[model samples]
Target: MKMQAEVIREGELEKRSDSLFQLWKKKLVVLTKDSLSLFPDGHKRAKGKELGFGSILKVDCVERTGKYIYFTIVTKDRKEIDFRCPDQSCWNASITMALIDFQNKRAIQDFKSRQEMEQAAGKR
Candidate 1:
């Protein structure tokens, strides 16, 4: 059964577009335990792109200006997606904490699976 992801934080964040202009577009972002969803229309019902935490390597704070805190999300494939939020929003910190939590849970699950495999082999 597929489990529903819990919402950790939801807010409006500015994402640097990959287009030639490299303009920053406002995205309605929904931060979940397992993924970050970007809604283009700033509505929950709108179709959005989901970036799973499993594929994300880390979030790096790139720059900090007086108005906004810029950060980059590096994916496993080495793709860097830039984002920014208001200085007080703490979006970077929120994503980092959630990502760490997801990674720790995955590590625990992997360790349990290895133990179970070893136990089965011993029984045989």
Candidate 2:
């Protein structure tokens, strides 16, 4: 669900549809590159799928109490989630990831924008 603007040379503009001129297309250039860094280097793409992440969609974290943190993750199909974990390490990563996901969700206009991705992807 990303887009780009590419100019056509000569008189090719008239041959193509207006949508082709500049439209938001689901291009894998960003996904594949991201997949490479998120997953292992030799990781292979899942078969028969537009996205390798076939199940889980997003992750969220919430501070429940003084010593408790909650994780709320939604699936690709809008599934409900209410998970609570007392583990500090897990909760820390969860909170960090959620914060990063929010800050870098779509603030950048460019796909190569690695602002939020790095903070979340780091080995903390």
Candidate 3:
């Protein structure tokens, strides 16, 4: 089934192995404001995996060697998903920017909610 998400950037990238011995696979990658999705092919029938920003602790540019730029997506629970894209593709940078924006928006919303709750408590 197709995922229902507001698309930020969608394209193809290589998901690399997290192990010391690396392997790469081409996949269709989807970046939303709040999550990243990867599908085996550019078709709806392909099985997909989703990683939400809420669980993502950080995105790191691990290394750039030769024509590939390696990166890692670390989750709050300490899980790391590694990926690599062509140096010219800039997929890593775009994903990082979108994730940072999402986090900033969330922080502002959370701060506003806390302030409103405190004001209500003071009034009571």
Candidate 4:
């Protein structure tokens, strides 16, 4: 499937799995205007996992210990996805900015819709 939005950034990052062991998997991460996509190494047919901005509630920078910076992406469903990468990569900041932009656009659209509804109600 083709993505309609432009890709903001693409790189590899260590994703912390939700399993009991909390294993870190190295996956290729692609950040677009609408979603984040993950792909396995050299995988051609797999679509991998896509996390849309609408389902993402917030992005949090948890801590920075030595070489790696820790961050978490919290979904609207209350699920937390953890990630850590090299201090120089700046993956955490990039993702946070993109998510914020998407959220702000969504908020503006919601406000406009609500205003239109209120005006229609007043007219009736």
> Which pairs clash in model 4?
none
Decide which is better by lDDT, 1 or 3: 1
* Structural similarity to truth (TM-score) of each candidate: 0.94, 0.31, 0.88, 0.88
- Which candidate's TM-score is highest? 1
Rank by lDDT, descending? 1, 4, 3, 2
Q: Over the stretch 1-124, how does candidate 1's per-residue lDDT look in tens digits?
A: 9787789999999999999999999999999989999999899899999999999999986688999999999999999999999999999999999999999999999999999999999999
lDDT per residue for candidate 2 within 1-111, as digits (tens), equals 664322111110001112535332221111331120111222325231222233456665555665555555455687634445444535435334433444464445344
Q: Candidates' lDDT values, in order?
A: 0.94, 0.37, 0.86, 0.88
Pairs with steric clashes in candidate 3: none
Steric clashes per prediction: 0, 0, 0, 0
Tell me the spans in candidate 4 whose CA falls farther than 4 Å from its real position. 1-3, 42-44
Please provide, for model 3 over 2-93, each residue's C-alpha lDDT reduced to its tens digit, 9 standing for 90 to 100.
66878988898888755677778888898998899899877647888988899998898568888988899999999888888888888889
lDDT of 1 at 12: 99
Candidates 2 and 4, the one with greater lDDT:
4
Ranking by TM-score: 1, 4, 3, 2
Off by over 4 Å in 3: 1-3, 18-22
